[model samples]
Target: MAATESLPVTGGRRLYVQLGITLVVLVAAGGMLAAHRATLDSGTDRLAAADGEWLLLACLAAVATWVCAAVAQQGAVAERLPAGRLVAAQFAACAANHLLPAGAGATVVNLRFLTRCGLSVRRSATALAVKAAVGGVVRCVLGVALLLASPGTVRLPARVPPALLVLVPVAVAAVVLAVALSARLRRAVGRGFADVREVHRSRARACALWGGSVAFALLHAGVVVAVVHALGLGLPTGRVVMAYLVASGAAALLPTPGGLGSLDAVLALALTAAGAPGPEAVSAVLGYRLLTGWLPMAPGLLVLALLSRRSAL
Candidate 1:
């Protein structure tokens, strides 16, 4: 009942978010044309001259992210949602993420979708939280796995810094102490543990949650790899993936919508650090954003608006 009641509110918010993004795009487009015309033209020419086959792979990988998102969302709960709508919702959510900060857009669209599909409000929110928690863990694990599987892929210090080693345990202890002392946080942690345990009870659900999340992260990184190859950038793929994971994690600290400017800047720096030339690194970042960010907007907007048209039950 609470879920049903909250649908209209979230749905309305999502509409506003999309509309706001449309306006920003229009304004940003004009600004870019006027302010960065030369750069735009350069990027356009570069994109035009890029390898078609690699670009196509990037596009496909970008689309595959939506499917993975849907799978993870489904795995977050025991209920079976309609596959088609789930994908559409994820598409719309991803689109919204580009406009709103801290995942506000995704929260709106997905929560509404879950409620519209009959999940209770609390369960819907919990599912989102659970998926997020699992996604973070999976990203770290994947990065470590890649490092171990591929020898000398990324350079790490042969020994941990003495000061850093001491600080790490202190930080962990501080966090645990805070959580243990805060009743609100304690309840939140309890709820998260309970939901995670429930998800683990179903073998398929656990696999989908972890596997889908890992695939989603890899596919997103694959876009960067494809774009690099498309532009004949000679950086190693393993290094690019590791750089992307690090840059993306850093970008999350900033509240930029879909990580627009923040991600571009950080990722470009990461690529450069990974041995890509500065200009080429920026170009690769532009190509990555073009595929992952801009390309999905049109379809996502249409899907969001269509979802908004339905009445709250």
Candidate 2:
């Protein structure tokens, strides 16, 4: 009895310790963000004279992004998720994603949530893989379509880097080698493919999965469009949408948590190429990030903590 009781106590201490370390890391990241306050403010200032109504619309679009994400998550699994809890988990995952590299935190939260909601570990994992694969394909296809339509929005450099050409094949080969070398990985891939087929076997599931994903990307782009209109940016709406889809698809290649710096840079450059002034482009990106990333972060974190306390994390 003593040993068992002591085990829980020790486990509690470890959880707290881990939480403290997470807080420390978050604070460090916050400090780094603060260091760029001047740059952020300069961009934000450019929106001072913008229309309030447009900004409100942008906020609405941002809200829709979260809802769409939740819908997509629910669609990923055949089992129905409790509506309220599923949405809350998605919100929390958004916040958690910012804290860890390559969306690891979000993955952990979702995996735990799915398991708690009565999914086996493998099934839960398969749902995530299916969702990711489908979403990636949708985003890439949409991005390519947009890019092809508005080629001028993305300008290529005069000369391709020789190193990049070599690096691409090397990276591809390395990934293949890793998969070939690992039996577990090969099994996982096979299982994921089977899961994908299972998910698409249902017409309703297929619709929800694809529909939610398209809405997620489009609504996010709509937020940017709203910002452009709010700030009276002369950039064409179609090109702005194109630029966002293309840049975001490319930025997804980076492993940064939520694609923080890489996404910002890519978005800014894309917006500029699309013919918005540098300051205005930066301002629009800042506003977009403010709505999607910063504003909801605190509440998302709180929800995450509450869920964790309930052992639903």
Candidate 1, clashing residue pairs? none
lDDT of 1: 0.85
lDDT of 1 by residue, 1-313 (tens): 9999999999889778767856675565345335535655667777889999999999999999999999999999999998988998999888778777877878878999999999999899999999988888888888899899986777787998999989989999999999999999999889889999999999999999998999999999999999999989888899999988988887877897787678889899989988999888888988887788676776676677676665321
Q: What is the per-residue lDDT of model 2 for residues 1-313, given as tens digits with 9 covering 90 to 100?
A: 9998999899899789768855775685587568768877786666777889999999898888778888888888999998888888988888888777777878988999999999999999889888888888888888777768877655678899999999999999999999999999999989988877887898888888899999999998999999999999878887888878877787678898777888889999989988989878889998888888877777777788777777777
Residue pairs with clashing backbones, model 2: none
Flag regions of model 1 displaced more than 4 Å.
Answer: 1-39, 157-167
Candidate 1 weakest ten by summed lDDT: 28-37
Best by TM-score: 2
The lDDT of each candidate is 0.85, 0.84
Write down the TM-score of every candidate.
0.86, 0.88
Model 2 spans > 4 angstroms off: 3-22, 25-29, 147-178
